[model samples]
Target: MAQQATPVRTARLGRALGPEPTAVSGAVLLLPAGEEISARRPSPLLATASVRALGRRLSRTGREDGLVAHVVHYRYRGWNGPEAHLAADADWAVEEVVRRYGDVTVCLVGVGMGGRAALRTAGHEAVNSVVALAPWLPEEDVAASPEPVKQLAGRRVLLVHGTNDERSDPELSFRLAARAKKANRDVCRFEVHTDGHGLRQYRDEVIALTEDFVMGAVFGRALSRPVQDALAAPPPLGLRMPLAAGFGRSLRH
Candidate 1:
């Protein structure tokens, strides 16, 4: 006689880390750049000071404002070629935030592959805003998600791309913006004319532009003129451990 074993689910997902230890009023999910070629956790792009420091600062601000800042580490480097994996992961993160906080709002920010993932996920019920940075649009062969505007009618969206980007075409983003605008979305498209995909030459500008938009879109507050003028002033440095979770079977990871 043979004994039957329990069934195991086999869906791949992503990891989530939060700055908010408790139920938050709102949240922002930060996603990194990567592709099917490399689904590395905390993509190398995230290791850079420009990206890591920005995550830290954004987390700190989220804490101060009763918001949660969750950074996602995807299990697969590819978007849903047919399964919508990244979009599903992002949606799961948003659902988790709302589940804990109750009617909580959400925002998304992503770079490269993450950027496309953000758009794909923007249609989630809890997402009110999204910021895509130097997003790498997909080719015709790829089933990138539907035009985000159709899913995110009332949501706010900001697309920032570098004119000199050699890795991706900024024109694609511009066209997306136009599409969003035509759909009656609250969309803003910004161009960093001299920067490339990493936005190396204009990191500060990217940070300011994004943070400002996230605050307004989710929290209804962008920086005031005085604060904007003083953004160059560095605040005291502090550190905190992130509240880590993964998708599906290993959520607590």
Candidate 2:
């Protein structure tokens, strides 16, 4: 019988859109969603398709701040249980950014499973903050090995979840935010009401909010009142902060 062949891993940073590396002051790493388990390398994922647009918008908007953005292409489609292959890929991407940019601040922006990976990789020295959009947080269980919050120390974390998200539990993200807030007072979670996992109904608002948070975290730009209050307020209030409409407009003025 022929032996099983291992799939070739191809985790790497895709083409970036932003200022030249030498001129960059800050950076954003975009991680797209993936499956829960599979060794096969990922093809073009729906999540990746959506994130590409977001990445372009971010790159364009953040240009004034000397921010460069890159989307990470994962080696595998699956989280692979404890193996956490996605997180490892994200970690490598961070190192790669550090290597190329040299001391510039980095923000990790991830959606769905990629959100979970961003949270997991926050401990990297180059990472200054994280933005998790509709992050998929698994229910606490011994086997699943609940995602740890200790790594988030000193790093600002923003978690955005849609209330109607069925694909990933909003409650789980709330719980994780609460835990992360306890560990690092800079943590906050926002609820996008009436939206689902995709957050398409208010994509502009979400992007604005994300841009605001990333810029603030990476470049020390002034943060909006809701974000500031969310970070300062104690549990329950902070963990359940509402994402309001016209937020992007507010940022503009």
Candidate 3:
């Protein structure tokens, strides 16, 4: 007899089904909230309210727009482990989507640590855009032979952070955006005022921007130009300006 196959454990991944059948465009790979520590928490793709709201909109619009979406549940909680496990999972998902959909466009939608993984994966050929919400920015100078988040030269990346975020510093994301811009990449960093890491205060606004950016802007069919412009515009705090480089605003603002 053949050996029995091992059972799946501590992880889940699949394509999200829509309300009903509809036309198709591209795909959205969603990585829900997570942490970099070893604590084992429930997968945010299934548990987080923010992700649920975004998922509902994506399901509806995906049916109407005929697009595909997938949510990832990592095998672990932390991303700073030896394997860079989340990034591997993301690479697999992107490859799987391309295998099924051909050489089509892709949008990476991630929150927090998940967003970090998404940013690391957005340089892949199929990925056209990335929307990282309250992302956890990586540290400077990596010991890993090849840095995972280094190939963002030509991709469209959008990062949104809340000003009052106590969990992760919004300035880190802003700094990464500035660095990418300096590298001649097209990047947008939006700062939502007075909100924390969860962004509970402006849930609707966050969802709407994610939907518009992923569905409209990524596909470049509808809601593209305006959403693109809004994202590309400097943050309201004026920190995105030239004079603000290495400024003291990050300490207070």
Candidate 4:
């Protein structure tokens, strides 16, 4: 019998666009999606094509003139516990990015537990915008989590969740958005398809919103009208779902 070759695992590269700012222009944080166990171990949820595509879209924003994108990796609490520890870690990461990068604008993007982390990070001084995908900030956890709304008041936030997500209901995202809006923050919400707590169905809209949010934060422009209009349109479907077990297989490159 012939020996079987073991698959090689590649480090998921965190990409930055534009020159490292002499004074940091802006920073975007990307957190892994899933519960604590899933987050600790590699899973297809984090390596989906939509996830990679979102990263690429964010990287493109960094290529724009006068803007830089800094992507940082952080650990988040999936379903293991409430978000206290994850929030603390997120705060530390945000502060570190600000300290190292200078007075850079900050944007937090999280999917699932990562979304909760992003909201927690929003309490930091440098965070100016947030994009939460199917975030898991339950009402009970809000008291324990940092006051992200206070820190993010008057900032721009885009919340997207799948109505079919069973892990964390989309209505929770809506409730969070409502709180943000009440604080006079610029908030936008989008609903997508899928029942497994993933954002595969809303990839394009998510990417566009992310780009728009970052650009708007750095340059003081309103979200691009086209992007906003597109988001307002009805949700689209038929996106191929990535296999949770096969994510690392595609990283051979």
**Steric clash pairs (candidate 3):** 23-66, 24-66
Each prediction's whole-model lDDT (CA)? 0.63, 0.89, 0.68, 0.58
lDDT of 2 by residue, 68-130 (tens): 999999988989988999999999999999998889899999999999999999999889899
Return the clash pairs for model 2, or none. Answer: none
Per-residue lDDT of 176 in model 3: 74
Looking at candidate 4, the ten consecutive residues that score lowest on lDDT are: 237-246
- Order the candidates by lDDT, highest first: 2, 3, 1, 4
Please provide, for model 1 over 26-141, each residue's C-alpha lDDT reduced to its tens digit, 9 standing for 90 to 100.
77787777664533344434433234565665666566566766666555666645665666667777776677678988888888777887887888888888888888875433
**TM-score of the candidate numbered 2?**
0.93
**Model 1 poorest 10 in a row by lDDT:** 235-244
Please tell me which predicted candidate would have the highest lDDT against the true structure: 2
lDDT of 1: 0.63
Tens-digit lDDT string for candidate 3 (65-108): 66777777677677756666676677778887788778778888
RMSD of 1: 11.0
Write down the worst ten-residue block by lDDT for model 3.
244-253
Query: Model 1 TM-score?
Result: 0.73
Which segments of candidate 4 are over 4 A away from where they belong?
1-23, 36-51, 75-83, 139-148, 193-196, 226-253
Clashing pairs in 1: 80-84, 246-251
Question: What residue runs in model 1 are displaced by over 4 Å at the alpha carbon?
Answer: 1-23, 36-51, 140-148, 222-253
